[model samples]
Target: MPKLTIDGIEIEVEAGTSVLQACEALGIEVPRFCYHERLSVAGNCRMCLVDMERAPKPVASCCMPVGEGMVIRTDTERVRKARNGVMEFLLINHPLDCPICDQGGECDLQDQAVAYGKNTSRYDENKRAVKNKEFGPLIKTVMTRCIHCTRCIRFAEEIAGVPVLGATYRGENMEVGTYVEKTLDSELSGNLVDICPVGALTSKPYAFHARPWELRKFESIDAMDAVGSNIRVDVRGGQVMRVLPRLNEAVNEEWISDKTRHAVDGLMKRRLDKPYVRGADGKLKAASWDEAFAAIAKRVAGLDGSKIGAIAGNQADAESMLLLKELMQSLGVASIDCRQDGAKLDATTRAGYLFNTTIAGIEQADAVLLIGTNPRKEAAIINARLRKRWTMGGFPVGVIGPQIDLTYDHSYLGAGPQSLEALLKGEGEFAAKLKAAQRPMIIVGMGALTRADGAQVLAAARQLAEQVGAVAEGWNGFNVLHTAAARVGGLDLGLVPAAGGRDVAGILDGADKGEVEVVYLLGADEIDASRLGKAFVIYQGHHGDVGAHHADVILPGAAYTEKEGTYVNTEGRVQRGRKAAFAPGDAREDWAILRALSAHLAKTLPYDDLASVRRRLVEVNPAFAHVDDVAPSAWGAFGAAGAMDAAPFVTAIDNFYQTCAISRASATMAECTEAFVKGRQEEGKTGTHG
Candidate 1:
């Protein structure tokens, strides 16, 4: 460690810690356009220049490592002059269109200019201009506003690992643009807009929206946090202003998907504002909450708890999850499940109490075997890590998935029941390599397995480990990708009713067979209603979707934004999710509804708040014993659980904008979908199925 003084404050930091970091540690603010916490230090902008006691000239602080007894002055006259000169140079070509610019109120350049720049420049020369190039739908660019800090370029080259963006000219003539105006094809392309230091790059949709001061920030989770993530939402006038990563280090870290950032608009879209019921006329009709609940109670009263089933979607909050389980148990239904039938099964004992093996721990594994899932399309961040593991030698990545997912970057494809045998038997060169490697990992998620037959895959994965001697004793080797923010936690709570049906499909089939008198849709969907018969359906969710369309009764529910709950991550870490806003309209938390309905029937479930439910979670599932103790906002480094870390790198995730409901509704993603369809037609494989 080295001791350094920055802005008259002294602090000790690791020998390798940059002076800028030391300054940050000592609570000294240094303004710079190019420097980011994650990216490599360039020191190109010169805005971080500081006057050091020994150095004759000011030095850029971002690239300078801390040294013993180094004294630095960031606001001295000499340092101020240097920074002001640099700022003057930066403003020469800048458009200075702060009023109409999307990044106006929040632009780092504007702030720095006000703080470090002189009132005017000495040069009377013409400002250089560069041609604007079309990047893609999500981001807009005005090349004249670029400061050449290369934050966006570095983010593209290093973080995202896509060469779509780069500086195209010499020195002052340099411009940030794509090669030949080709579409910015990277899945994580939208992030460039967030990182650009000036008004050069902006979010196309957010342009001309309310200024930054007009928006309010809210801390919330995403639809995926059912998988355990904490995120922040910037809202203005009851609508989402933007989405940014909240530092939790455990789940999402200081990173999030375009989906999590943009999907917030779903709260205002096609919402179920009022209660509804299906009529004899075969259409859903608006009804009072009392009328709907009464009908549900009457129908539920006729059923045996053993014949009932409930399924919860991964997007619902933990409160909603607990409520649904209570309702089912009261109705004597134990066949509750969220597993997608017929894909894969996770019989690894504590199936739902799973998290990402600590967010980037997969990067450290000497070997990775992906069984039946596409990280790129579904779990983008994980896929990005796996890609780095594969491409940059972070590790040798192996795939046993149903498809040749591009995220594997260098994958050996295997599928069916035989997929596991290949790794066990070392049938191919890829499998042989994976078998011979140490620190091997098997990640199982959506595609290879669902709630249906995912157990078979898990069995095969375990068998492969046993046969190949790949798994280390007492360590997590087989990882199942969980779906919700608190899916792991909810499952840990043993919220699955004792008498519910086997799965949703089983209940639907029972409904088809007239065995179930009334079907309760508990925060669940993803079924094609066209396959089921005329059984009474009850839908409970924030969104009005196909399930609500077929419902005999409907109940509006609170989204993750309006609920307080605790989630157990797949890594078995407990996280608290607090409410950041109110329910939209006539909407109740899932647990509230279950509590009301349970009280109505004169029964009580043994828990009160999110904390109490978590206690029951630990009681029912001993696998989650540590969950009650982990703090909600706590996060650990990747591979901190005796695991290796990924490279000093970040992988751009899948098309986040395309995955979320709001972005899906955006014309941008729709255009991409159409283009994809066209490409499929061009490939002459329009109807191919995997």
Candidate 2:
């Protein structure tokens, strides 16, 4: 421990603790621009200069290490003059555009300048102007206001692992951008806007929108992916202006994907604002709630319970899924499934389908083996964590799927089930590495569990995990990376078929063969609607997507942002998302819709409100009783056995931007697909960077 005195206050800190950190511990403030707690220390700003006893003059506190009996004075005259000089130099090149700047209310530079900078400038020389650069459709750049903090550069190299951004020139001629003109290819590019200290980089979709003060903020959970990232929704007049990342170390640590941040536009577009029913003309027409309910009742009236089926979508919350399950059970309907991707998941045990080694636990892993999963697209934040782990050294990763850049160094094991079988037999060098590691991880994905031989693949993965001690007494590292935000929650609620019921494939097959009569889609849009044949489809969702397109009745329901609901992440952690904005006109909450329809069907559910519905959820599964807590599932046998096939494994997510109904309806997401997905494909064809 090193003892230090700052402003006549004495304190002891860790050996490697910096003076700036020591000052902050004693309730003293240090102004900094290029310093972020999560990022590496870069003392380039010189804004945190502090006077030291028995020293030459002032030193950068952010990089200055504390010593035994070191005296630091942060409120002295020399420190004040040094900070003022640094602030003046920063303001000299900074453009006077805060009035129209998007970062006006919440900018770090704006606040620090007012407190530390002089009242007026002394020089009258013409201000330097730099040309703005493009960083794709998601980020709007104004390089003229840049302070050269290099936060974005470090974030690209360390966090995103893209290394596409860098300083091009030296000194006064320096500019931060790609060496060649191109949009940032990282899925985490939107974080640059959040890390920048000034208005140099702002959200392109959110440009010229409402300021921070004008928007009403609501803390919520993001439903874009299975990470269940903590987020804050900014609403202006009942409209979602933007979504920003909230700090939660157990989950997403102050960062969100571009889709999570920019997909608010989809909430206002292509919304199912009113109930609709297919008339005698075979066209959907606006109808009252009673009429829509009647339409569903008319089709399901004398139909056999075995002929009725329900499918939950990716964004379906726990409350609605529970009510839907109860309603179906009461109606004697056994055909139901939440695995719209037709994944062969064994919901019998919670550990079989959860990320057993929680997101934070990735840092503790020594070896990792990815089986038919692309964490970069499926869960960008998880990939960032894996990169962070890899950067610490002594961590080795092996991939057993399609070769893609995971933003880290990983060995490419063979492509399919044969490679997995080989590892089980201890026939590879990577398998030897897995056996030698203390805490090894094996992550299974949809690509391995959505095929004809999915059960066999799952059994093999479990056997490999058991053989390599991945699932042991103290630590269980066998994980399943899910792409849907609702999959874990739906499974936790036992939304699978009853003992005599069929899975998703069997339900769809029965529908095509005239064995199934009524199909209820609870926001399920990813399934093949064409295969429903003559089945009367009833779609209850917030978007007019594919499921609604083929529906016989559309009962408009609330989106994630329009309702208070619970969602479980891939780690089986229960999280609750609050209602940020109201659903469009005539649309109601999902659980309320199901509760109302239950009465029409003569099978009224007991729960009347959200609280009652959540209580019922806890009864269905005790895991729902603890919100924001991860109750580790007891590790046991996966109980799956079959023969392995030689087919090559494919990547689960084809397009990262347009995965679900909301993102498919987003114009901003569409633009990203054009500039990133399609543009990259075009670039690949020409062998040139765009």
Candidate 3:
């Protein structure tokens, strides 16, 4: 520990901690445009100058470590003078155009200028003008507002590990730009916008729209797809303005995918807001809340558990999942599952019933083994965290998957799944090198294959782990990629179907066989591919997805933004996200919809709210009983089991974005819309929100 004094207050910090961080730890405000917690320190802006007793001049607190018995003055007159000078120098060339800039309301530059900058400029000569560049879809270019703080440049090179933006010249003539004409293509590219200290880098999707203050910020979980990232929505007048990451260091660490960050635009589609049911006249008709429940009750009451099937989509929250499971059990529906990738399940289940790894835990590991999962597509935030790992004494990363392109800076890459057997035998030596390392972690993607191929991949990964002697050390384990930002929580909720239990895809397939009498798809979408036949179909979700379009009965359920619940991520840490708004039109929480059913069934779920549901979920799933203790800080002591064999296959599971029906409906998810725009847009834009 090192002792330091800032503004007359004494403090202690770990050795090598930046003086600025120490200042922040003491709640002392030292402003800087370029400094970000995640990016490497670049003291280019010279804005965070602090007075040290031993130094002749002010020092950049971001890069300077505090020394024992060190004394610094942050609010001294001398410090204020230095800060004002720097701010004045930066603004000489900046345009006063905050009105139209997307970052106008939440701009750091504007805030700092009000605090430390000289009120009036002394520059007499005409100011230099900066031109804009076209950086393409994700990032809006507004170079005139840039102060050349180098946050974006350093972030691209250091944390993202894809240094696209950089300085081309020196001093006043210098500018930050990509080589030739290239747009950022990294999975972590969206972070640059957040990292930008000014309005220079804006989001094209949200440009010139709602100001930060104009929007009502709602703390919510990102239920779009698996990885179960937490998020906050800035909404204005019942329409979402922007989506930003809500901090849960154990899960997303203030980071979210481009899809999760922008997809709330889909909610704008009016198709989702109101309660609707298929009338006896065979037309989609708006229905009362009680009428919708009555339709579900009549069909669900007549079926035996064996004949009835229920599949809760991965996007549903832990409370919703538990309620769905209980509702199925009450209806005597044994065929209840989240997503069926028995192949991934068998592998992860044999290892343990819970998350084998988490986003933050990877930072503490000595080695990482990614088997059959593409972080680039499957888990973008986890990929970003892994990329950050490479800068300071990189951890060894080994991969066995289909992608020739991996977002993480990989240490070893076997050819593909076919290379698994040979790789285990050290045929290529890449897998051999990874196994020999200490503190290794294995991550498996559920999207690797259909049920059949997943078993092959899991079996191979297990055999290789055993051959490499990864079992005894307890530093290694398995992580499966499933759907919904809350997929990790689904396991924690005891929603994993039992052996030989009919999975989601299986239940749909059974409809073709005239075997299923009733099917309840709580946010599930895969049934869109199967025939409904004479079986009664139920839809309970936030959007007009597959179930809603074709179901005989529909129940409007809450979006993640509409309800409060606990969603434990791929790491077993549980954090509660609060509901931001009332469910628009007839939308209520999934638990409420299911609770009403329990009212009719005479079987009490024992909890009146989400908290009670979590209690019940934790009791049934022993893996989650220890959730309070696994909040990332205690990860070094987290005892995760080593690799185990795959279970017999059932159905394939997709990653979060592809698995959920609601996320695909998002209009502002620019990346996702680009993928299937032709197919989706042809349906015509509903005057609703997205």
Candidate 4:
């Protein structure tokens, strides 16, 4: 430990702690453009210069390591002079366009210049202007405003694992670009806009939308994927203007994927704003909520509970899913499944289906094995963690299933059950590596466990894990990587098939065979609706996508951003998403719609409002009671234990941007998807042309 004094306030920090970190610990603010906590120290930005007693001049505090009994003065005259000179140099070639700049209200450089810069510039020379180049559809560039901080460059190379950005030319003529124009193809590219100190790289879609000061910010979580990255939704006039990342160290770590950041546009397009019932003419007629409910009740008037089934969607929250489960159970409806993809996941225990070691625990493992999952598309932030661990060295990662790029150096294993079996028998190369590792991890993706013989695959993976000592005294690294944000929460509430209940496929089969009279779809659009023959379908969701198109009656409901609910991440971290904006038009919250429908059926739910529903939810499942706390999973016997199946595991997500219904509806998301596909097509064409 080293004791350091900043402005006469003394404190002790661990060895090798930077002077900038020490000042932060003492509640001192050190202003600098190039210093970000997550990125490497560039030390090029000299705005954080501070005077030291034994030093000749003020030193850059960010790169200077603290020594024992070091005396630092942050408010000295020398430090002030250095900051003023640095500010002048930085603003010499910078543009004066704050009025039209998208980053005006939140610009770090603008704020710092006002506080520490000179009143007037001595230079009357012509300012250098650099022409902007196209980066992509998501980010717009104004090259003249760049301060050459290299934050974007470091982020692309280090964190994103894609060194797509670089600085070309000498200091005076230095230009930050891809050199040759290239689209920023990384899923985590949206973070560059947030890291930029000026308006150089602003959101292309939200360029002139609204200023930050005029928007109302609401804290929420990203339901785009299973990582459940924390976010702040900015709203203006009851509409979500943009989405930005919120700091959550346990899960997303202040970096959200592009889908999470740019999916807000979907909330405003192709929305189901009013209730509707299918008319005899085969057209959807606008109807009141009461009419929609009455039509549903009348359709299933004579049917028994065995003929009724409910299927929950991937984007549903825990609170709504709980109420839907309760309503179905009350009606003796045993056929209830949250998985729309017919995934045969083990719902018997939390450890059987959760990422048991948690996301933060990824750093501790010496060896990692990924099974049937492309984490870059499924959960980009978690993939970044693996990349970070690999960058730190001594971390060996192995992947089974698809040999696609995972943004890290991973030992590629074969793509199926036979490879897993070989590893279990200790007959493979990586099997020996896993056995030798002190802490080994096996992350099984939903892709491997969603097939006809999914249970067998899961069992084989578990057996391999046990054979390699992955679950030992000090470490439990048997993890299940989920792709949906609500899958774990649904499982926690016991929202699976009961004793005589059918799974998703079985439910659809019953409907197809006329054995089922009514099927309730709760935001479930991924299923093949044409297979759901003649059954009177009632869809409750916010989007008018595939589910709404096949529905007999549509009940308008709130989107994730328009409701307050709890969502469990892939790691069982329970996070509460607060309502950011009001529900559009005649749409009500999902739980409220469920409750109202329950009343129309003369089976009024116990809870009236969201608070009461939450209270009852906590009573039913104690995990729902612990907000932002991950309840440790107690492992039971694996339910899917069986013999080996020779089928190769498949990857779940194909298109990362257009996976969900909400994302598919957004024009912005659609544009992005088109661009990505077109870019790939162009690349293929060039390769063939060559």
Cα error, residue 465 of model 3, in Å, equals: 3.3
Ranking by TM-score: 2, 4, 3, 1
**What global local distance difference test value does model 3 have?**
0.69
Q: So what's the TM-score on candidate 1? A: 0.86
Q: Write model 3 residue lDDT over 136-176, tens digit each, in one string.
A: 55688888788888888876676666667777777777878
Where does candidate 4 have its weakest 10-residue lDDT segment? Answer: 681-690
Q: Which scores better on lDDT, 1 or 3? A: 3
How close to the true structure is residue 689 of candidate 3, measured as C-alpha lDDT?
18
Expressed as tens digits, the lDDT of each residue in 341-428 for candidate 1 is 3333322345222443455566556777766655665555555556555666757666664444353455655455465655666777
lDDT of 2 by residue, 1-690 (tens): 989889999999999999999989999999999988888998999999999998898999999999999999998888899999999999887888899999999999999999999999987888888899988899999998998999999999999999999999899899999988888999999999999999999999999988898999999999999999999999999899999999999899999999999887999889999999999999999999999998888888888899999999999999999999999999899999999998988678899999999999999999999999999999999999999999999999999989999999999997999899899999989999999999999999999888888878888999999999998888999999999999999999888999889888888999999998889999999999999998999999999999999999999999899899899999999999999899989999999999999999999899867888888888889999889999969877673687877889999898999998889889999999999999988988999864
Q: Output the worst ten-in-a-row residue range by lDDT, candidate 1.
A: 640-649
Model 4 scores a TM of: 0.98
Descending-lDDT candidate ranking: 2, 4, 3, 1
* Cand. 1 Cα-lDDT: 0.64
TM-scores of the candidates in the order shown: 0.86, 0.99, 0.87, 0.98
Off by over 4 Å in 2: none
Question: In model 4, how many backbone clashes occur?
Answer: 0
Counted clashes in each candidate structure: 36, 0, 24, 0
